[model samples]
Target: MRSALLTSGTVALLFVLNALFTGSLVSGFAMPPYILQVLCLAGINIILAVSLNLINGFTGQFSIGHAGFMAIGAYASAYVTVAWGDRFRAATSFLPEFARDGVLLLFALAVGALLAAIAGFFVGVPSLRLRGDYLAIVTLGFGEIIRVFILNIDVVGGARGYSGIPKLANFFWIYLFAAITVVVVSRTVKSSFGRTLIAIREDEIAAEAMGVDTTRSKVISFVLSSAMAGIGGGLFGHYLMYLHTNSFTFIKSIEIIIMIVIGGLGSITGSVLGAILFIALTEGLREFSQYRMVLFSLLLIVIMIVRPQGILGHLEFRHFFGRRRRLAAPTPPVIP
Candidate 1:
């Protein structure tokens, strides 16, 4: 109950912050539009990184087709909003305009997440049996296949890209979902099911021998990860009011992987920190746009060489603070 209350309070506080940032509550205190865009993108990246961590970091899966699920979500949600948005809004016409739009966005996000989860299940069932590079190859292929498939679907503008999506996503919605993603992934990591995933990551064969349903656990993780990614993609689509297969390519998946790896593979705190840093660095280097990739690559190389295990090296924020508290505590009197 306390945890639930705390979560609610945190969400409420975030809502107020979002209002301030968007100038909904205080026009004088509004953040700049460019800054708000960067923060919104950061929130989406946080959702993607944290969700992918559940599969790759916790479940020891090497699936790299995260972008495929993201694409599915983006296009699926955009299709709904473009095709039936008016109907949805009409059904909820009694509500204020903002509230009606929010409801429509929520419904679209749900559809995207559901479709992505379904795709994840289908892909995970067969590909998850393979380990390491083989799984990665399958997932990579899946992502490519999804892109190609979407390219041929004229209903969604084919290769031309899907446009005309409503701009319903705002700071409040994006950060709210990001916070929920963090809470869900963190709680899962602390649960018994999460222990099973960690055990599988440590030793799959041993975990299987110990009677853990490794396959089921992995598939479930994949579905949950995909659903979260879908939510992120939904927000991305609505925020940009566009959808393109090019955005959800193999490179996109790699960026998410880099976020988790840079933070610490097995740590949720690391994922959040990594996503923020990655986005900040990317945005900060916009002035050198032509040489940005080269500079980014060099910086990543240096970071890897300096701390290959990641910024946090599998340790969480709580662990770090707890260690500090322990060190600061007064020493007990020794009886001589």
Candidate 2:
């Protein structure tokens, strides 16, 4: 009962924080709801980073086609939502009493995630055989294939893009998923499976010798990570109510990678911090928008030069948030 109370309290605290961050507080900023968009995008990016971190940072794989998985979800969800939206509203003349107005939209997002997971499974199966740069190349090729496929698929509006999606991705859903992502990932990383994943990263040969199923771990991590990316993509698509093949290109994949890389490859908290920082920095650099990428590139180079391992490489949450364990109090200096 105490534990339950604590859990409920934490949830309530998170709810309050979400409202404050997402709701209108100050009148002078005039930032609009787009800040919520940034928050959602950052949350999704954190998932992608942490999930990919499991592979690259913990499992020592080099998969790089995250954006492809995201595209799959976005397109899949878009198709269902558009088709169902047309039919449901047309037939019923309005949403049923049993249905919230946003039910279709939410369902479509889930469907997007499901389809993306399937795609991730297929892609992971093949790419799990490759390692390092070879795996990166293979994943890159897969991303391109997805992009090309979307470009030719007229059902999703092809290159011209799809629009008219209901904008139902508010802060509530976004941060809820974000919190869930963090909780799930943090728990997973603390499990035996996560330890084995880290072992694989430390030395795959050793892990294999110790009976760790390296390939299976890699595939699972990749699929889960890809699924999260897909969900993010769906949120992104619905938020804009429009999406184009161009949005989920190789460059987008690289940006996701950069978030992980800068955030400290293996650290979930770092990913969240990094994503928020990246978005802020990108937006802040608007003064030199033309040279924003250039400036970012220079910053990355400097960080790499100074700390090639990454900014917060592998630092756990306890390092940042957990209470400090005091050393034994020197036996009170034998005061007696």
Report, for every candidate in turn, its global Cα lDDT versus the true structure: 0.92, 0.79
lDDT score of model 2? 0.79
* Candidate 1 lDDT, 257-328, residue by residue in tens: 989989989999999999999999999989988997798788779879999878987888888675454456
Instruction: Give a tens-digit lDDT track for model 2, residues 253-312.
Output: 888888878888888877777778888898888789999999889989987899776788
Give residue 254's lDDT in candidate 2 (0 to 100). 89
What total of clashing residue pairs does each candidate reach? 0, 0
What TM-score does each of the candidates earn? 0.93, 0.87
Best by TM-score: 1
- lDDT for position 323 in model 2: 96
TM-score of 2: 0.87
